[model samples]
Target: MRVVVIIPSRYGSSRFDGKPLAPICGRPMVQWVYQRASQSSRVETVHVATDDERIRAAVKAFGGNVMMTASTCRSGTDRVAEAAERLGLGMRDVVVNIQGDQPLVDPRCFNAVVKPFTEDPSVKMSTLAFAIVDEREITDPKDVKVTFDENGDALYFSRATIPMGRDGFSGYTIYKHLGVYAYTREFLECFRSLSPGRLEEIEKLEQLRAMEHGHRIRVVVTPYDSPEVDLPVDIRRIEEKMAAMGIG
Candidate 1:
């Protein structure tokens, strides 16, 4: 099965417009995401899926592959699904959806998400979650939380602090959901057919829709923390982090 990485980018954003073209340390943010995803040994090819001509041109100018998707696509995942359909990938082929906003995503995280499929052919969908080491993140609504079953399948995902910690926090760990995901082409099609769930609508998390529909989402614990650029102010912090890591 071939492993293809698709980064869904749009020029429009309520918080930061034209975010894909925003420069960070000389290179556009989307370029950084594309370059980092290309470093993964498991990914066969990386493509940027965008509806905007500016984003397509920027990606092409950087010598990266670009796929034009429909502007009506609601979310990044929808754009990825359309792109995968256009590519005519096999049902078993793996598709990794890496968010364009996450410029600090670790290359190893890609390998981690793909491992579940390699080990078990029955695994249809998988995602990455990191241990919540920072206490501030536990209360931060921006840091989405996930709780999985003993089998490592995600039970629920929410923006609020889960498991309530009412009994005092000990022996349990709170995991912050990362924006990366991996799925088979078949599952992607299945996901598209499902309607939004009540919990998903309440939490505003798309992943919850899959869980609400009784689909199993394997949660892979990753050590790396991927900070996404949601606002224009986040660029400076990402640039500083990149510089500290000796990345240009």
Candidate 2:
């Protein structure tokens, strides 16, 4: 089971421009992501997929593998699929799509995501989910929620809180959907062939496309909590965490 981790990074960002190149501590954000992915024992190779020449050069400067993708890619999944085709990923190989902004992503999360493929040969797509610790996250539209079946396969993913509790609903479990995904080459080809579903358009979640096409997506639960950098103020929180951890 050879696994390749692809970090999709683009220079243009609406919230924080040049986010991939932003310096975290002494290194670029993407560099941190790449380094973390490389630590995964299950991952055979790590590649940074980007559209900007500056990002490509930066990855190269750090002696990291990088691939140039087209600017027209609508999402990170699309970018990774293009890279998989460009790199000639065989049908049997597994490709893990890792988020570029999550500089502090847990290596264990990557390992857990790819583990399902090893257990079940039929599993084509997989992702990670974390139990929400705060009640505020349950109602926050930005924090996507996911519900799974008895087999731990995802039934639905939505921006709104699912399994609506009764009037006095208390202690109801909630899970926050992580953006990381693992896809087999055959699933990637099938994913590209489907049209975006109405639910996906309504929620702006690309994973819904797979469910719409009747494909089962295995859900893996991870105990690690990742702090994402989405706004300018987020840099301060990450810096403070790094300082406390002595990561430089």
Candidate 3:
């Protein structure tokens, strides 16, 4: 039942290079994420998993724990699985995967994502979801939408509008998939081993791989919204949001 937070970082980004090291409110984005994640009362430890030495150095410079994974890792999940193996986490230990790009992730989101594991031993993986309040996000490809079953298990995660109204129906709520995720160390290892699924490759949503493999991911609805830094301009937006929230 140890909860370990791992942030998969990379120095290169097609949209914004050195994204993990990018400064936000006078601190590197990764540092902000690490510090916030550490604030979670449920988290036992936090580690920055990166293939780049500069990101490793940056995390180390900030007195944060970091581990180097194989550069060949194609996604955050792969890097986290490797980091989990290196850290020697037990099979049942809960591994929280917090994306480095989300500097303003609420510490409470960590607890929300990890709660399912404690309540249900069969829950091997879980993720946060928020009911979309902003109207524009419903059709925005950048905002991934998720549909869940009555039991809160994810039915689908997509970039396109889900529960599409063929006849202009608009009564349903669309949930935005928050980047935060949690997995048992064993399932994480299994996730990394499985080949990418067709829907995962098509939608470019890695979470779909689990569903395609018949794995039911519990969707934890959370009130907190964690925005990501996709381009250089997003830093200022995050800073503004942080400042408005009185958060550094």
Q: What's the distance in Å from true for residue 10, model 3?
A: 0.8
lDDT of 2 by residue, 1-248 (tens): 67999999998888999998899987998898899889988999999999999999999999999989999998888899999988898987899998888888888888999999999999999999999897888898888999999999999999899867876437777899988899998898889888999999999999999998899999999998676889767877888987987775
Q: Which residue ranges in model 2 land beyond 4 Å of their true spot?
A: none
* Span of ten consecutive residues with least summed lDDT in model 2: 163-172
**TM-score of decoy 3:** 0.97
What is the C-alpha lDDT profile of model 3 across 122-160, one tens digit per residue?
Answer: 999999999999888889999999999999999999999
Of 2 and 3, which scores higher on lDDT?
3
The lDDT values for all models are: 0.93, 0.90, 0.93
The estimated TM-scores of all candidates read 0.97, 0.96, 0.97
Against the true structure, what is every candidate's RMSD?
Answer: 1.1, 1.3, 1.1
User: How many clashes does the backbone of model 1 have?
Assistant: 0
- Show model 3 residue runs off by greater than 4 Å: 167-169
Q: Which residue pairs in model 1 clash with each other? A: none
What digit string (tens of lDDT, one per residue) describes model 1 on residues 8-124? 999988889999899999989999999999999999999999999999999999999999999999888899999998888999999999888999999999999999999887899
Better of 1 and 2 by lDDT: 1
